[model samples]
Target: MIEESEKGWLLDNGLVAYALRVGEDGVLEHLHFGGSLGSLAGFSAWPRQAYRSLQIDDRGKPFRHLGTLAQELPFFGRGDFRSPAIAAPGLDELVFESARKIEGGLDLGDLPSARFEGAETLQIRTVSRHMGLEVVLSLTLWPGHPVLARTVTVRNISDRPHLLDRASSLSIDLPQADRHIVHLTGSWAREMHLQRHRIETGRFSFGSCRGTSSAQHPPFIALTDTDTTELHGEVLGGALVYSGNHETVVEKDEFGAVRLQMGLPGGMRWPLAPGEAFIAPQALLLHTDRGLGGMSHGWHDFVRERLLPERREPYRPVYLNTWESAYFEVDEDKVEKLARAAKKLGCEMLVLDDGWFKGRRDDHTSLGDWQADPKRFSRGMGELARRVTAEGLKFGLWFEPEMVSRESDLYREHPDWIIGADRDRPGEGRNQLTLDLSRPEVEAHIESVVASMLREADISYVKWDMNRFVSDLDDAKRAHLYMLALYRIVRKLRKAFPGVVFENCASGGNRFDFGMLCLFDQTWTSDLCDPEGRLDIQSGASHFFPLSALASYIGPSPNHQNGRISSFEARRDVAFFCGSRGFSLSAEELEAHASSVKETAGLYTSTQSLVTKGRFDRLRTGAEIIWQLTSPSGDEVVILYARKRSEPNPPFASVRLRNLEKGSAYRMEGSGELWRAESLMVAGLPMPHTDHRANPPLMKALPTGDMATALLRLRRV
Candidate 1:
C-alpha cells in the first residue's frame, strides 16, 4: 500500500517499506528502505535536520545538494557529481520536474515486467527540454513481497531523434558507504560463483557484452555491511529481469553515499525517434534485515508465487535425458532401449536431446529445421513418442529454434532471416547463426515451426537451447528487440501449449535469469555434470534461485564435460537436491547399478516435497559439504558430501542443522535414533571416520572417501 504523508510518501508492502519525501524544492529524496514499518508516523522523526548542513550554499541552488542527498532520479551533466543513472550525450542536462501515482503498472510494449494483483506504482518524470528527452521512471511495489520492481521509459518529445549513451532500469541510493558488494561471476562451466568485495571510492561494475547474458557475469548484484552473514545482518539485492546484454554499476560518492544502477550495457547507443519511446528492462530490488538467507527466501518466494506458472502443486519429474548417452547417434531402436531402461529405473520422462531434426547428424547442421530427420528416425517422432509412452514414460524433444545452421535448408532458402551486419559474413559459433527474432516474419516462422513439431509429436517437454552468442548485428537496438521478441514467442507458446514444460538452456546457463525463469519451468543449470564442479555451481545458484528452478542431472561417470570420474552414489546425491532429478546416461549402461538406481528413484519420490519446497541450508567445513532441506511442517533431510579424504588430526567433523524447532523431538530416518532438536543443533552431527559401514552409522562415524555421499532424514515427533 502507498500513502502520502505531510512529510513524505510511504510505500509499504507487508514485507518491506520504502519512504521518501518531497523536499522544499519539490525534488524527491530517498529517506529509508528496509523492513516494514506499518505506518509513516516514524518518518516525522527521521533526521531531515542533519541534511540541512549539507544543503547550505550562497548561490541557493537546491539542486547542488543532490550530491549529498539521496535522489530519486539523478541525471548526468547536472550539478550532481555522482554517477548518473540515465546518461545521454544528446541530453546532458536533465532534472526531475514532477511525480505522480499510477493505478496500474506501465506497459512496456512487448517487453515483460513483473505484475501482481495488488501492486501500486509511482512514476517520476525527469525532463531536459533543451535535449528533447523526457524520462519516466516507474516503481512498482506488491503488497506482500519485499521486492520493488523498477523500469524506465525514455521518450523523444522533440522533432529529431535522440540517442541514449546510457540508461538504467533502476538506481538505488544506499544510506551507508561502508558496504560490501556481492556479485556472481565465473566462466561457462562454472557459472554463478559468489564473489564479495568491499565498496571502493570509484565505480565498480560488471556486465555482459557477449549478446547473451554471458556466463562470465550473471545479472545479480547485492550490497551488505561488514556485519552481514548467512543468518544475520541486512542485505539488499537487485536482479535484472533481462536475458540479453546487461550491466550493473556500483558507485561510492565522496559524500560516503553508495548508489547502484542496473540496466542495458553502456556500449549501445539506443536510438529513440521523435514521438517514440524506449522502455528499459525491469530490475527487482529486495531488502531483508534478517540476513542473506532471509534475502534468498524473499527472492524464492517471489519467484514461486509471482513469476512461475501457476500449478496446483509443484511438479518435478524424474527424467532420463539421451544427450550425453546417445549424443547425435540416437535412432528409433536406441531410443526405445533407453526408454525401456528408464521405465525399469522408475524414470517418468525420456527427453530426446539434440540431433533429431532434419539434415542433422552433428551440431554443424539442421538447427532451424524442426522436422524429424527421415533417415535417423525412420518411423517418425510421433511413433517414437508412442513407444516411449508405451513404456510408461513421457516424451520430450530438443530444439534450437532461435538459431539456424548455415548448412541447413532453412538458411539456404531465406538467408535474410538471420541477423547480421551489412557487409560482414554472419559470424558463426557452434556452426550456427542467430535468427533475427527482431523481424516479425522470422519470429512468426519460428513459432509456426516449433508449434507444429510439438503438436505433431505429442511432446510433453521441450528443451529450448541457444548454443551461440548473438553477433554481426550493427544496430544496437536489435539486441534488445531480439530478447523482447523471444519473450513474446515463448509467451505465445506457453499459452498455446499450457501443459508442456519448457526448460531454458543457452549453452548452459548463459541465459539464466529471473526473466526467463518467469516463463520457463526450470533451467539447465550447467553443461558440466561433474559432481565436484556441480557442488560449487549448485551451491552458488541456490543463493538466488530455489531448488526447483535448478535442473540437475547425473551424467556418465568420468563426467562427459570435465572427464572427472565420480561414484554413482555421489552423483545421484548431488543431483537429488535439485528440484528436478535426472540422469544423462543410457539406461542400459546403468544395468549393473540397476538396484541402486531404483532405490535412489524411490528415495527421491519419498522426499520430493522436502527437496523441492523446503528451506535450504548449506554447511561448508573445509572439503566436506552438508546441505539441509527442511519442509515447513518440520520434516528435514540433509545430504552430507565429502569432496576429499578426511584428515587424521580432527578425527571427525561436525555439521549443525538449521531451521529446526528447538523443543521438538526428532527421529533420524535410517538409524531410528531419536534426539531433541535443541540437542542435535547444539551438539551437531559428526562425520564418518571410515569408508565402509554395515548398518547406518551414527554421525560420529560416517563413510569417509573422496566424493563419498550420505543421506540423513529427520522427522519431528
Candidate 2:
C-alpha cells in the first residue's frame, strides 16, 4: 500500500503508517510514522516549514535548518549537531532527489534480507552536494502487519574513496523525548530479562560489542509511553536483523527531540570505493497500541510468514536429548538404551549431543574431527542413527560446527582454519577455538564434514552449537565478516538438507536473536531449563520470539544447572508453553517417572497446535508468572500459571482473561464448568481452591507449594 502523492509518499498497511514529504529546501522530511490515519490528507501541509524557533540556519531562514526538522537521514556536518546516521566526511545533507514505489522489497545485494513477496517497498533516493554520494533509504511495508522494515544504502559516485566510520540501517527523529526505553540485558543462562528506564535529557545507549551479539545485550529496543503495560498502551519497538557486533542508540537532543538509530556499531572502519555501495543491516520498526503483546505478535507473525515460512510451519518435534543423560559419555550402547526409554515416553526424536565424534571423549578434543568415535560407536555413527530410527523414532545429532579443537585432525591438518591460527597462544573459550568462517576453505570444510554426517544417517534434526566467541575481535570488521560467511554456510546447509530441522544453541540463548531465527528453525532457549528458573528467561524471550521457536525442555529434578528440585508436574507444566518440547532425563529417573512422562507427552501431542502457535498473552501477578494463549482460530484457550513460592492462607488468586469473543461460552475442560466470555474476561477466572466450587469440600488447593504450576484449558461451547 504505497501511495505516492505530489508532495512525497504515504506507506500504509492498515495497521501502521509511515509518511514522508519533500521540505521547502528539497530535503526529505519525516511526516508521520506511528498510527494510521486512513489516508494521506493534510499530512505534511504546514509542518514541512513550521518547526522554526528563535535560532536560524546560516542562511538566516529559521526553518531552513536541518537540525530542527525530522529528516529521513540526518546529516553531521550540516546544521544537525546530533548523532549522524553515518560518519563520513563531506556529508552535507541528503537533498531529496526522487522516491519510487514498487512491489516487493529492494534487493540488498549480498546481505541477508527478509521476504520480498507480498511486500511493498518505497525507495527514496537522495544525494549529497560534496562527494557525489548517493543515498537510498528504503522502507518496506507488509499488508496486515504493524511492522515495517527499513534499510539505507550508500553509494560513492565520486572518483575518491570515502571512509565510513559508522553506519546505521535506520534513523528517525521522533517529536517526543519523554518515553521509556525497554531493553533486554543479562548474562549466559540469564538471558533476555526486561530492563527499562524513563528517557531523560541525555544519550542512553546500549549494544553488543562482543564478536557475536552477546548474551549481555541483545539487539532490541522499545520506546513506550509511560503507562504502557503488557497488554495496553503505546509501544514502538525496533529490532535489528543482524547477529554480529551491533549498536542501538536512543538520544535526546537539547531541543527536546529524541532520535532512534539501529545498525552497525561505531568502532569499525568501512571504506567505500568509487562506484561501490554499502548496505547496512535491516531494522524493523513495530508500532502497537496494544502494548508489548501487540508488538510481540507482530514480530512472531512476521517470523512465521516472512522469515522462515517453510521451516516454521511443520509440527515442532518432541525429543529426548542426551545432553544431561550422558553428556560426553553418550556412546552407542547409551544411545540405544535412551532411544528405548524415549520411545516409551512417546518422544518423537532422540538427539545424541556432544561426544559422538572421533577422539572426542570430552569437549577439549575432536570437535572439528566430525566422525564417529570408533571405540564408543562400535559400528559407526550411521549405524547408531539407523538404530534410533529403527526403534520407531527419528534421530538428531549435535555438532559444534563453528568450533575446532587444536588436538583434532581438522585443526592439526589445517591450523590456519582457526580464527587466530597464526598467534602462538590464540585465546579460547570452552576449551575450543572458533573456526574462521570468513575463510572459504573453512566454510567448505565445515559444510562438507557436516553434510557427510547427515548423508550417512537418517538425521531428522540437527542441533548446531557454537560454544565460543570470536576472541580476537580487535578489528570490528571480523564480526561482520564472520556473520556474513556464517549466513552463507547456513543457507547452503539448509538447502542441502531440506527435511532436517536445525536448532541453534550458543551456550544457550546467546544466539537467541532474529538474525539466527531467520536461518535456524528453533533455538535452545537456555541451558538452565529448569521450569522455575526459566520463568523470567522464557517470559522475556516470548516478548520477541514465537513459542514455536523456543526449545523448552524438562530436565532432571535437583536441576542439573541450578540444583533446584522441582516436581515433575511443575517442570512439565512450564515446558508446555514453549512450542518445541523435550526432556533430558537419566535412565533411573526415566524409569521412575515413566507414566508421568508418557502422559504429559500425550497431552502435548493433543494440544500443541493450540498452545504453541497461538497468540500468547502475559498477565502479571506479584509472586507468580502466568501465560495465557489463544488458539489461532479463536476456539481454544490455554493458561499456564506458576507460583515461585506458596504462602499459607494467601489471598484469593485470580487473573483476567483476554482476547475472547464477547458472547461466547467456554467449558473448562477438567472442572466441566461453563463460563461466559465476558464474565471470564471482566470478572476473571479464580484459581482453583479447596472450597465448594469443587464438588467435594476440603479438596486440594491449586498451586499449593514452592515451584508449583497449574494449567487451565477452555473450549468454546
Task: State every prediction's TM-score relative to the real structure.
Answer: 0.94, 0.96
How close to the true structure is residue 242 of candidate 2, measured as C-alpha lDDT? 84
Q: What's the lDDT for residue 30 in model 1?
A: 76
lDDT tens per residue, model 2, 218-324: 89988999889887889998989888888988888776778999999875777789998888888999999998888889888988777753754568768898988
- Total clashing pairs for each candidate: 2, 0
Locate the minimum summed-lDDT window of 10 residues in model 2. 690-699
Off by over 4 Å in 1: 40-63, 90-104, 129-132, 691-701
Worst 10 residues of 1 by lDDT: 49-58
Tens digits of per-residue lDDT, candidate 1, 111-225, equal: 6666556778888787887888898878889977799888988889999877887778878788754899988988878987889889988889899877888888989988997
| Whole-model Cα lDDT of every candidate shown, in order | 0.80, 0.83
Clashing pairs in 1: 688-701, 688-702
Which pairs of residues have clashing backbones in candidate 2?
Answer: none
